[model samples]
Target: MIPAHEKSETHSKIDPDLNSKGVDEEGETTDHNLTYYQQMQEASLEQLAEHRALLQIFNLHQAGRIEEKWKENESLVVWLGMQIAILKRDFTEYSNCPAHEYNGENRETDEFDEEKELNELHKKVLELTKLRLLELGMFDDFPSKFELVETSRPSKNTINKRFNKLLRKIPSELFPSIRELKFKNYIQSILDGIKKITIGHKIYYNQVTADLEEKGKLKFDYLFQTIEFLLRDHFISENDLKTLFQEDHILRIFSIYFFHSSQQGFSSMVKQLTPSFITDQCFWKFGFSFSQVLDEKDKVRMNFELLIAHLFFNGNRLRGFQEWDSFEKSFGRKKYLDHLKNPDRLKLSTSLQVEGKEEVPPLSLIGTDQEFSGDVNNLVKLFLATLNGPKKTRALSGLVCELLDFINSNISPGILDRSFKKLGSSKNLRLQFDLILIPTRINYSMAVAMEFHDIAERNGLSLAPKVMESIFISYQDRVISLNKELIKVYSQFKNRYGSLSSWLKQNPEYSKINEKSLNQWLKAMSIIIEECATEAKELDRRIQAAHGTAH
Candidate 1:
């Protein structure tokens, strides 16, 4: 006899017939498919959510607990795994099948990952078993004090493993070599490749190398100039450059190189760049990605600060060398003339004004397709998307610095004082503007749950629990997709920016604010991260209850 869990009706609910429509031969059955579709969609979403929750519980369970459960499900689990393997085999070949030419019996199966479906089914089975156990009050059987004492006792191997785990959890900044293994490998390969190029072009390589290597030390200017010449001359292909320097690894490498080769401080190193280099219009010479060079230190706060200083004050967009290949190739094109014009009010004042120094040359804006504007609102969008993809917090942070730079450069002290008085309430500040205008779903959901619901209710608009659940779950997925690096960076930004703004307000001087702002931002970012994390926990509970998964 089939188990109640494996009933035909259960299977029908799990697998909707895609070809079915609202109409049926019998008038009474006309809405059957429609009802089925709605119910199936709802069940599908609940099951999907339960899959995630079960995965989390599995991850968090102790090894002993996992082993115990595995024993309970061993044979059925193995059979399910084999079935999944067969489904995967069929699915993989379905893509290449010639049967796709017809919609008849030879038609290819609809696109899907068979393994994924089977895994979901497996998880559902386990969830049902878990529910049954819960119903039986199995958890109410508490262990004796003696048993607890014995189970809690740690062995020598267990203690060592725990210590190692703690060490592994330590932030990567303290162990760069361990954390940046991929980066280190790539850098070494590039250096080796460059060193080998000297074999064929011995004279040219020696000349450049000798010029750059002054008294057993590599000069930064010489290094920059040589790299620029090599790139401009088509000595290095765009693909090779991208492979070597993509994702701002160049910034980290430069940081390491600077520590080794230069006695000058980070600020001094930046001071060497020309005024035009920092402005938005221009990309760098040979391309260097300086987005998150200091990401490991001070929890990305310092990275943001350095990026801002480098771009606005020291004058390096640090966009990376790949961009230079395109810009250099299109050098003479009368394109992007709009941006080539004097930057909008958004551009930070050049170091010429900051240092009270003479103009080095005519600051020719780099011609580009993208226009640079002073609008922090649009910039905040890029900042949020950066959480999901390639552009790091550096872009947002640099823009923040630019906004700060402009405010300090343009706004008077008395006006700034007035702005500070209205600071917490006013959304004019760039950071606050970002918090208000970023348009994140979670931010909106939080507002609705806390305040908007009441306003909506008064206006005769009501929010359904399902709508709120959807929003929170969507946000949870986004947070999960951020992986680790971005989560830390974003948390840091939300935390640090508040204090950074406050400190900047009190001090009101860019020169005085300096890197000391790093710690203040770090502390603030940590607090924000903790608060948001707590909120996420609460949201998870609500989501579970909505899905009928709460204990």
Candidate 2:
């Protein structure tokens, strides 16, 4: 009887057909094939019922719910073993069939060494059952049916024994080696027959060896086949191959292979290969290359491509390498030209004049793509211009450094400051300082102050009465103006003093003004500023005292 599962599988594969009998002239009554069909139907139903019962028993055993008495049920074991053998046979038959064409007939028949075939099939079933039992941790009890098969057909056992001996002789690992040797010989035979496959065309074999050596041994044939498939599929072009090989660097080759393989699999090869790699030195080279390339469109394309490549590779636009690459690719060459063509790009002005130094006005800043031709003359003109401008209008020490950076120069802060100071007076420049210039100048001032403080402290001059007084006063004034609470606190102090000048006589606790207490002072002063009145006058007094000036 057909099992329920097998019946379902068969039903899914078959379609019902209509059967007809002789019809009367009026088409009202006719003899039908109902009796024959009913018999077939009854047989099918009985088969299905038997199959269902077998399935129930199999499921019970599978789920470990079968009773101990039923564990050794020979009938159930035999049925299951037969089902497994049939499944394997059917699977092999279907696998071997040509998918594009079919002939209507069972491929296997009983006449062809049926016992040997059945024995072999039974062995496969036993192997699978053993594997299952192993997985279930029930390896001790192999079914007796497997052992009884040989005795049941003693003559057949001799052939089965020989086959089993041959199977035992074959090592699983050697199968692949044999397959490879056969494939190689087949290809060699083809070449020998064709007489066209020369050693020169065997470049791929060498490449495969080298790749294996470098990347660790892998399936060369598989990789080669994949590359061939990629080429055939138009996922990668000849240009890409040429470019990747032309580089010849091992790392670059590795990168290209990785990129190409991944992209081929996903069709993103073009995106992967479009970008050029970047490094610190690459920026300078790229800049130089951009300058060498004359056409604007070519320059833009090259620069933009480099920029995009840098961005893609680094995964950031503002990183150190990325920014450098972008800047050099974008404006390095163009700026060089502007330095030559436009005087404004190099302009400078200062108010203070020194002996033998000519006064100059500030040069106009050049825009991104403007042309300039003055070159050295523009630089000289800018220096002179910056010297002649108001002291505040002169470039700050940091600005000078940045300008040097733009020109790829290396002028020290002291030299730059001295150069500017020689040309312009500090007071005149101070009046012209804008917020843009203020931060730069303030930073420079703070830097200079820190340097001076460091040098003085190192030499024991920082603690001098005058220096200490000046620093204290300056810090106090800053604390008051910078923080409203400090101003308010100073106001309260002034109210207690009954006059601003009297409050100035009170010395601040300088020992408490160390770095550790600076933040505390700031907080305390914030409260004072917020709560105090007449704060500005008190602040002025403190500044005068600190500066060694009397109000």
Model 1: per-residue Cα lDDT over 1-551, one tens digit each: 11111122222222211223322122112244456545544433433333223333333344346445433433222222222332233333332333222223322232133223333433332333332222112122212111112233333344334323433543333324323443234233434433332221111112212111221122232233233222322223333333343223343334323322322211332323211112121111102222111122221222322333333321123345343223323332122222222234224333323332221211322111022222222333333333223443333333443333333333211122233233343323443333322322222222222332232233322122343334334433433332333334335455556754564355232212123443343344344345555755665565566457423
Q: Which digits, one per residue and each the tens of the lDDT, describe model 2 over residues 337-445?
A: 3233333333331222334432221232222112322222233233334333434323222232233222322111122322334446532232121212223322322
Off by over 4 Å in 1: 1-219, 254-423, 428-551
Native-vs-model 2 lDDT? 0.29
Query: TM-score for all predictions?
Result: 0.18, 0.15
Give all candidates' CA lDDT scores.
Answer: 0.30, 0.29
Candidate 2 deviant stretches above 4 angstroms: 1-317, 320-325, 333-369, 372-437, 460-551
**Residue clash pairs of candidate 1:** 278-315, 287-320, 287-321, 288-320, 288-321, 289-320, 495-524, 495-525, 496-521, 496-525
